[model samples]
Target chain A: MIHANDEPAVPMGLPLPNGKLAMWLFLVTEIMFFTALIGSYLIYRNGQPTASQPWPTPHDVHLAEWIGAVNTFVLICSSLTVVLALWSLHVGNSKRAVQYIGVTLALGCVFLVIKAYEYQQKFAHGILPGRVFEKLDSPHGYKYMRHVQEQLEHIEKHGGVNDKAKKACAELLADIRAGKLQPKDVNERVRGTKSIKETNPGKEFITTKDSTYVDLPERSRPKDAPMVEGILEMDTHAHLSYSIPFGNMWASCYFAMTGFHALHVFGGLVVFAIMLVMAWRGRFGPQNAQMVEVTGLYWHFVDIVWIFLFPLLYLV
Target chain B: MSEQHHDHSHGDHSHSHGDHSHGEHSHSHGGDAHGHADDAAAHFRSYIAIFIALCVFTAISFVFNELVRGGIISPMTSATVIMIVAIIKAGCVAYIFMHLKADWGKVYCIMIPVVIMCVMMIIVFLPDGVLGWR
Candidate 1:
């Protein structure tokens, strides 16, 4: 029979304490979860068609690498603080442990705040998955030509074409009237369209199609070009329609991986808050210092995930 | 055993057995207060060094990407180097920050199977997902 004062027998073949082993087991599940997510991302990324559906680069999506780098630094610093907190506890320094944990908590908040700002920017740009860009093969050229035709007609009605350019304008009108320049022909050459403001003082009031101007290159024609060309050139600001190929797929992966990771960070912040309270209450000392170390393990795992993610998402 | 229990319970009778047991275990390994302080100092310095190394790795990745963008280095080379650097950073975090180096317990026994499972998942999915076989 065991006496009241007898120490409890260690579990057979169990090398670690129960709490630590359980934490490691939990991390194993987490590792699998992230691995699956990242694996799927890689497959999708690698399988993308290079020519037809090229993946969008970081520039195409306006992802700021410096911000990501700063966040990485923040996380690394937080990881260091977490370890320091655990170290302080091991040395029986409860006040310093609480201070370190507090710093870690603040760093976590900074990371989330920065993440929230990035997400806001993405939303503002309409960069959500399935809506990253206009449909590939869209009839943007046809629409652009139709807008051109309308602008030409408006110039004719308003006598906007000067005498020096009337001849060229009439010739261009003949081409359109004779079906020489079909919508499909222009559509084939049209990549994308963007809105521009009319820069010429005289043409400022000349209403164009959709109340927007399309600026074509002035190098395409002479200085005293035709009315249509002149109207196209009047706008100094040219909006080009550029498509981000397979952008939806990229956005989906980016959001999923980073979103899940952010959630884990938030969870860690909550745990740190709790730990901070416990440390403040003087509950954490050499006796219960393992608690801080266990928590630090999870925090470090989060940092490791970000280390991989920083290069994959931001740098690459 | 009784004396050991008595020494642990002397100061922290309110703490649970789990807490005291862990404390006793670490203390057994710690030897004395002076030695424990020294170990903690070494750990502190190591953590600082690792943090600096991590920051440098992050900077290297950033600079490598910039070089690729500037056409000073090929994208392929930059990508390879950045990935290698990322893996090294993760390894450092796992090995040192996670305390796996100091405490090599059954955690690896738990980790090995999970690693194999992750690898198997990738292998199984690669064919259909990447090669478009199915």
Candidate 2:
């Protein structure tokens, strides 16, 4: 039977309807598109420098699992709505079709808004991608903790835990536990590129955040000596392929993948907006729903891509 | 209704549907409208059921993800289980919502290359695959 929305059967021997064939072809390309991206992610993640601690060590990145879960529900919910919209239209129920499409669009917007809020939180904390990634509380802070842990371990090995460095290590360890120092502290220490300097190990700040503090014994300075400052000195200009825990490879991969997916959601929203108006005008029903079906195909494909992305990035 | 007005505009065709015997009128409306309503309405319940299933799996996914983060399970094991659940969720969405279950047979032809490409991508990432070849 020739559907009102079905094209005159295609010239070729394609068994599928014209729109279905076209959508399937488009989906094929989309599959390959995501393959390139996801494949690159796997390669980069696997090819990281082999370390004793393993890749993506706990605390290396603090993804808000709750928000991610909420967004996942939103996407899945939107997929369900899209499905219902298609089915509703296929059953000669234009009113139900419009309602479902509207709900799907709303849920899609919710997903994007929550993602925006997540981005805002990360940005405030200086969690960004690539060269722009501000290591407010991530690899930078983790590195400091590891450094202090190493210093304490050294004292334990050499001086039987009674060493002076052990006391300093304990104080630093306290600072970490209390979450005393943050990206703000780092910025205050840096002040600007003018004040930012590469101070060596055991260096004290020129002006302490707390001046009345008892300086760690191992970090003592000579009287009348020129003032110095603190901040871990690491090469941020390292190549993406070489850096293990440093640099912003993880952030880069994350922004690239999630950003592209969000763009698709925006595109989907535009299509839904048009479809919502069309459905309101009573242009869609059981006899003429190929348009809605094709759009649903695209929406489902987007949902499928997110299924893999969520676990690979957040859960795994 | 717009449909009756449209039919009136084409007054030369006297039949109610104006469907030609040739069936080559490029998507002319067939004689029957809402003919498939019974079957579609019956299957509609399954759509809601699939939705409920999706929500349950979503909740399970989050709980399991939190457990993974909390170090209750090895990351590898957590990843495996999470991925399996994700695949199932995607399958339900595609097969039911996307109408893959009733889609024309040529869908297999479209899907085959996609699956092969995805598998090839995984193979290339394998430790002993072509990526490591000198």
Candidate 3:
């Protein structure tokens, strides 16, 4: 029962498919995209104020590590499921294959959900990738509070006659009018740059809406109203330059690469679902189990991408 | 080439001896079944080995990351360590877990494209790194 020469012969194992080739090619493009993003991040990171000042004392930034590790575990478990599913197909057990694929899809969903939760936490902490960073109330708040008291005393004593004194007074009045004056503004200008410690180890920042004051939640008062505490942290949130010239460029690329790769994982899930339906119908037998093999290759590639992304994003 | 075949079910199927020239090997029933089971188990074992290797590499990465983050090591040193470990981990996964060692030539077909892509990424990134320094 030989076929005609023109009839194409079906191969025994899936020897790579055009779609799989295309997916990998797309992933290659993604690698380049992320290289640019992460490279830019490193460059800007080197330029940071802390970058130059004896490697700013390391603070505990372990949240990224914890969340990223959990994500890695989820991906690894999903990979195991994918391998099991492929094995099921080879062993002529379509039912088990479908079961494993279902498990894999569930795990993928779990990963995405956890990622979303992490993003939410980042938002809540006001550590978003944007222009408006509300400086947190640090111990420097004490220094700012002192500066304000001294300025008030100077104004009371000499009637604020000196040119520098007058200018500081004017800036203070303007801040009072605008309700956005911060203590750092007065201290840096009055006491000079060297007097203030170069590094504020306790500096904290919160980011909420533009209208919200830096000390609003803590003070529970109108931003314009002068506090009686005499030690309130100044509101430098407006003057603070969150703009790292190349930060946006790096951020854009980071999101794009990770986003594109995530889309591929999503596409793989869709394909697996289709194959799952077919398997449920008993359409795939030992004679033709190429679908499972091809899908497994795609799933594995997605896993590999995350393996690379984890270190690049979180660890670095 | 003559179209030859072999009937492995000894004396069960009626076939001419001319079919034996095709090099289709046969095994005793118990031996063949045991060999297949062992092969499957070995495949699973390979999965375990790959997982363990991956965990070790990840731990190395984690330690290096701590050192760099804590300022005990420079960024360049950390990056270099990570790159070496990553390359080694990738090699193990690709060659063993993916069964590339069994067919090195075919594996190279996949690897060549990956290598080219990596090279292109470096080339494109070099200008950014260099110019950013200035």
Best by TM-score: 1
Could you tell me the interface RMSD of model 1? Answer: 7.0
Candidate 1 vs candidate 2: the TM-score winner is 1
Task: Give each prediction's DockQ, rounded to 2 decimals.
Answer: 0.33, 0.26, 0.12
Judge candidate 2 against the unseen true structure and give its global Cα lDDT, from 0 to 1: 0.60
- Fnat for the candidates in order: 0.60, 0.48, 0.06
Which pairs clash (backbone N, Cα, C closer than 3 Å) in model 2?
none
lDDT of 3 by residue, A34-117 (tens): 556555555444433232121112111113565776777777777777777765654456678778889999888878787777
User: Which prediction has more favorable DockQ, 1 or 3?
Assistant: 1
Candidate 1 local lDDT, A1-316, one digit each (tens): 8786696765564456566667888999999999988888877876743322335567556588899999999999999999888777666676888889999999999999999998987775557796544332336445545554554465556655455344444555566667687443332222212221111112223333221111222212244644233322332121212245566788899999999999999999999989877667767566656777778888999999999888888876
Best by DockQ: 1
| Cα lDDT, all candidates | 0.68, 0.60, 0.52
Ten consecutive residues with minimal summed lDDT in candidate 3 chain A?
Answer: A53-62
Docking class of 1: acceptable
Question: What overall lDDT, based on C-alpha atoms, would model 1 receive against the true structure?
Answer: 0.68
